[model samples]
Target: MSTQTDSKRRGQAFAGAFAGVAIVVVLAVVFFVVRNSDDSDKTSAAAPPPVATQPSAAPAQPTDAAPQPSEAAPQPTAAQVNTPPALSKEPDVKGGTGRLTKLVKTTLVPGTGPAVQKGQTVTANYKLVKYATGEVMDSSWSRGEPFSTQIGVGAVIKGWDEGIVGLKVGSRTQLDVPEALAYPGQGDLRFVVDVLAAK
Candidate 1:
């Protein structure tokens, strides 16, 4: 009876020890599973959210239409030329004549245009000569361009202002200006003037 009792006690002790080891292994497995689950939750909570993306724009297509003209560079045009008026004959002014005491006006050609007014601008071709010596002084015809002046105004000599007034366009007149009306120091003069335009 003593031997049997001792063997039963030894078997009970072995089973108790085995049960304790199994309980410890189960507790260790549970601890590792809970720790691994908490670490994954913390990692997910600290991570940043994904950002949304914008769509790209479409590329432009080529066109078949022609390009427009630029205003900065313009196309060229034809050139223009100017021509002088026609005259039948140039007048021959005689020189070496006696000095004129007063202003003398002689109409060589009659004009068909209107008479010049006091403030009108006059365009004319002229031939100037000295009264005492009959020397040719100036000729607008030789210059190829006519002369222009405001008549009956103080813009020119007193002789031209007084002589050119009331003269009509297309009329050619001879004027003999005395010393006082022509130039202050220059001698008495003569002018053969062709009236071209007055406005």
Candidate 2:
């Protein structure tokens, strides 16, 4: 009976020791799991969220800035100044009657306004014809506009520069331009011109 009792006591002690070791292992595993979960939460909290990009709806408007200083506006050349104006009715002009020996100027109607000056802009209506052919070559009346040119500045034929300078604003002049004073290759020509305005 004493031997059986001693054996029973030993078995009970070994079973109790096993239970303690099992409880310690389970507690260690639980602590490790909790620590790893806390570390993951800290890492996630340190990072920032990503930003999204978007496009604008409209372009920026221009500001009203002051203009910078520059050179004076360039003056119009002879060709630009001489562009034909709107035309009027045709006049009764007779040409090709006789040969022209030199530049001839005759004022048919005297002007009541100021006489034209050199380098002044002159607006006039003219009819041009061949001295020998009575045939009309060009007429501002036929065209829809009167002609504008700078007098005595070589903007027109030499005869016109010389003949139109002294003519008043309302005068009518007849010019017989010989080949020498007219176009180089063209023959003698006749012109009846009405001065409209000069400035």
User: Which is the leading candidate under TM-score?
Assistant: 1
Model 1 over residues 1-199: C-alpha lDDT tens digits?
A: 8999999999999999999999999999999999999999999898886531210110011121111112321212212112124333567887647767778888988887789899776667778777777677777666665666666655556677788898877788888888677654567877888887777
- The lDDT per prediction is 0.65, 0.64
Q: For model 1, how many clashes?
A: 1
Off by over 4 Å in 1: 1-87
Candidate 1 has its poorest 10 consecutive residues by lDDT at 55-64
Which candidate achieves the best lDDT against the true structure?
A: 1
Candidate 1's C-alpha lDDT? 0.65
Residue 71 lDDT in model 1? 33
